[model samples]
Target chain A: MSTIDPTGHPNVHQTAAELATGDKTDTLLQTDGLRKDFGGFTATDEVDFSVDAGELRCLIGPNGAGKSTLLKLVIGTYAPSAGSIYYNGRDITDLAPHRRVRRGISMKFQVPSVYGELTVRENARLPIQRFADGEERRRRVDDAIAAAGLTGYEDVAASVLSHGQQQQLEIGMAAALEPDLLLLDEPVAGLDVAEREAIAERIVRLNEEEDIAFVVIEHDTDFVASIADEVTVLHNGDVFREGPVEEIKADPDVQRIYLGDEQ
Target chain B: MVANTTDGAGSADAGGPMDALRRRIEGPNTVGNSRGFWIGFTVAVASLVAYPLAVGSYQASRFSLFLVYAFLGLSLSVVWGYAGVLSFGQVVFFGIAGYTFGIVSVNFATPLGITAAFLLGVMGSALVAAVLGYFMFYGGVRDVYVTIITLVSTLVLHTFMAQTAGDEWTIGTAALGGFNGMPTIPTLALGVGGAAFTFDSVTFYYFVLALLIATYLGLRAVVNSDYGRVMVAVREDEDRTRMFGYDVKRTKLAVFTLGGALAGLSGVLYASWGNYVSPQVFELAFASLPVIWVSVGGRKTLLGAVVATVGIEFVRNSLGGEWAFIAVGSLLLVFVLGLPGGIVPWIHRAYVDARGDATASNPPEAETVEVSD
Candidate 1:
């Protein structure tokens, strides 16, 4: 015990070291004091977050809590005004969104990004072919198609898919990139119970089998509780609380935020 | 995702023939892929190669001009079609490259080899365009900025050429031949056996045809390459392209320079055929014409651009003089308004539709089941 350095507690140090490795290590992503401002308005305050390898983390916040803005910042869709983001132990704070995707990160938008003019498979394949090449690309695309539960509906135009199916197809499109980290912005935001469960189960299964780290943003508490290993609560552009699902649900602050103080 | 689910259930129940039709339309292909594309390509090439021989000398000569325009249109297609950059000043490169050849052969030296002159013209135009593209593309210019910069640049070059045509230290505007253009510019000479043949109308037709074929094949190769894919991706989403580890500006500049070189090549051919190089070549009217050609043709398809050029030229040549402009202009309006996808895409669509293959309208179904959470 005396021989072991006190500064480097094995369990805590290992976790920290693992996180420090960023996207390459067991930690898929890490954000440090990320901030975003729009003129005089602060859209996202300094935020520190990390997603472990193959972990499914859900971000929950009420309206105007800056969840989407935070996601945009993470993807480099918006430049953060302050702090840094690391992917694969590389500082990617200033990288472009597409570059981030190319670096093994892919995101599904809150609204599906399917091309109405193109069929579902074509829409998926366009990005796949754009990003991938040779046999690996073909395999990934085929795998993603199957994974999305869109086996027989590939030829259907994206515009023609059911709402649930569209979301699944979008996930398939993102999955085609074979990303290490998948960001889902309210993937089940507007789906029915069955559809929500279907998507949630898919996310859990993908996490387990594909070993993909996921940072999901959703307002639905039940949905977040269902899939999340860790829940980060955002409130008014700042993190209100963060912990395990049970701990987050038990927090009085979170309950007050959701049900109001009087209640 | 939950909020909108209930609304879609009613529609799901009502799915009838439309759903069946949709399923049929969405099914996978049973036939092989390579056969159709190859057959179509072969037929197209055969038509292009045989047209001049079938139609005789005068029509063939006209076809040569059409080929030059096709090159010009293809040049603009890479810029406007694949890269989503609109250039109204492409004719400047054409004019410049033509002038380069004319000046080199006429004033500088009469015996300057054709190959040497052509190489010089192409290189010079490409260099100028690359430099210009660097400024325009990397300057963070978009839509209006691109339009104004290119337009102003063309006007500046045109005026400069007009003013400098007859200077004492210069090649002398007389050498440039001013507005009337240089006449009797020598044609390419092909050494056959122990003798050389002066490229006459028929010979020049083949010469231009060879160049056209080369241009078509070369451009096809380029467009099918990784570079071409990047260019298309840039066109689809520039921000996304940039994020994907590509310098969008560099890609744009490369496309622009390549396009310019092709345009210059067309210019060289035009100068050779017409035996002229004039400031009028750089004028706004001529500069804007190729854009129309690309629009009237299918933008993404190289074959479509060539076909449109030939088709438009044929329409113009048949009508004769002033009436040709009116007739062609009216036809252009009809093509632009009614057939925005251009003749080729429309024809392709009609052919596919007439074949009555349901899967023709959709993509193949997914084949496996990997994840069902």
Candidate 2:
């Protein structure tokens, strides 16, 4: 898959992949002093965040934490009132949502947003149709549907699908974009244990085999531990803790703020 | 060997040549796709053609006026149905083009002048829609707010035009006759001096029918195309569609402008057909008619818009009294309450149910997976 090295200023000497490959530890996404205020309330405040290329990171937080807001800010759904974002080591704070998508950053919302009237095949085809067509488009759509475990429900309208299936279809739609960075807001929030396990494995394979970076906003701590290479815990618009999954899992403060609050 | 592999399969080509024809008409963007629907479509077109032949030229000409309004219905259908932008300003664009056509045609007073007016009127409406649509979509005005803004825009245009009856309101040779309307404006014409061809009463009626058919089928092809699929996707979920690398605002703007242009065509024809242009075109009562037509018919189906427009307009013209409004209003209420999907889809659902088609409301077989929250 081709990658868009979005630095806002094109004609840079080095491509994004080259930078990632050269160091093998270079940050793929970073935010500096990022702040977003909704009137009198601030959702995300003065946060410093980063994600490495091909890394699978989990963002866990208590209810009302700013994880989703941060994801929205990164995907250009929410404009930062202050601070900036850099992708591939260059500024991209002002990029529009669709332009960010073209630059290989995209997200699935917390809610199921599949086209209820459209079939599973058609829903997967919408994002894929933009970049590929004919045999390639068909192949990508097929892969996405199968990845979502929706192979037999190809012709069925998305509305009739079980809630878990609808959420899975949304994941399929997002994955069909084949972005460099995929941000999922509670992707497996509504799935059962079996479905959740299947989705976790698929996401891991995507990260490992396809080299797609992820920032998954999740509530399930066990699910997070199963997949996250690194974990970032957010509480009340601040990055409360950041470390490897084991470290996050063991942190007492993280437990008091997030893991312990699991009710 | 490959050809022989599935040779015993329970299928045969319907004349082999017609197989390709089957695919284009029945895409996922539309509601009606059954063979029964196509047979009904052919019969309807044949009846339309035969009706004019049976009637006198005057009656045919009057019926053609009904055809002119079909474009307005189709315009609203594209904007509100597919693009998910509820607008009452379809008539605003129509009035603009009608007045523009009248102004330009009167000033030039030549065959070429009439041709220029056609281009100017249609393009003018599209240009206005582009400007207005830009402000609405890009400026973050969305949903029912778009409906309000468009409705206010229509009434504003109506109030403004109604006051343009004074002497200062004249544009070149044409007078802004205000509520009185501009009368005796030259009808639509084509070509150059000596080689000019004019659309006479009979010809104009035929021309309008032909144009309506072409526009309907052309729009069908459009709705079934990839772009139309995107339009439907946008209507389904704007944010989700936008997240998938689509400039959602631009998509809405394009469809809105196209709708404006279609309404402009109707306006141009209306001005020429009646040899008059009026502020009455933008009157609240008249302006709201396209909404009624589209809603009572199926807004999602282009043919529904056309059918409802012509059918309602025919009854309205014959009724000629307050009874027409009451009837149309009652019909609109009935459809809105009983059949919210509108006539075409309602009939289509029945047809599909009767056919036992797989692309429908059937329970999934076996292997039931538990739904989770």
- What DockQ do the predictions score, one after another? 0.18, 0.49
lDDT string for model 1 (A17-53, tens) is 3344533555667888888999998878888777866
Pairs that collide, model 2: A190-B373
lDDT of 2 at A5: 47
TM-scores, all candidates, are 0.78, 0.92
Model 2 C-alpha lDDT per residue in residues B1-373, reported as the tens digit of each score: 0121111111224456565555554466676455556677789888878876899798999999999999999999999999889898899999999999999999998999998998899999989888999999999999999999988999999889888997899989799898898998898898899988899888998889999988987788788777888999889888888789998999999999999999999999999999899888988888889999999888888878998999999999999899999999899899889988789778767766666665466737523344443
In angstroms, what RMSD does candidate 2 have relative to the true structure? 4.5
Comparing chain B with the reference, what is the TM-score for each candidate?
0.81, 0.92
lDDT of 1 by residue, B65-118 (tens): 887788888888888777778888788788888888776655433334555667
For residues A44-151, could you state the per-residue lDDT of candidate 2 as single tens digits?
999888898888999998887899999999988899999878787657889888998988888999887789878777788889989897678878888999988888
Off by over 4 Å in 1: A1-28, A96-98, A115-137, A152-166, A189-193, A246-263, B1-56, B107-112, B143-148, B168-185, B189-198, B221-230, B240-250, B317-332, B362-373
The 0-to-1 C-alpha lDDT of every candidate, in the order given, reads 0.71, 0.84
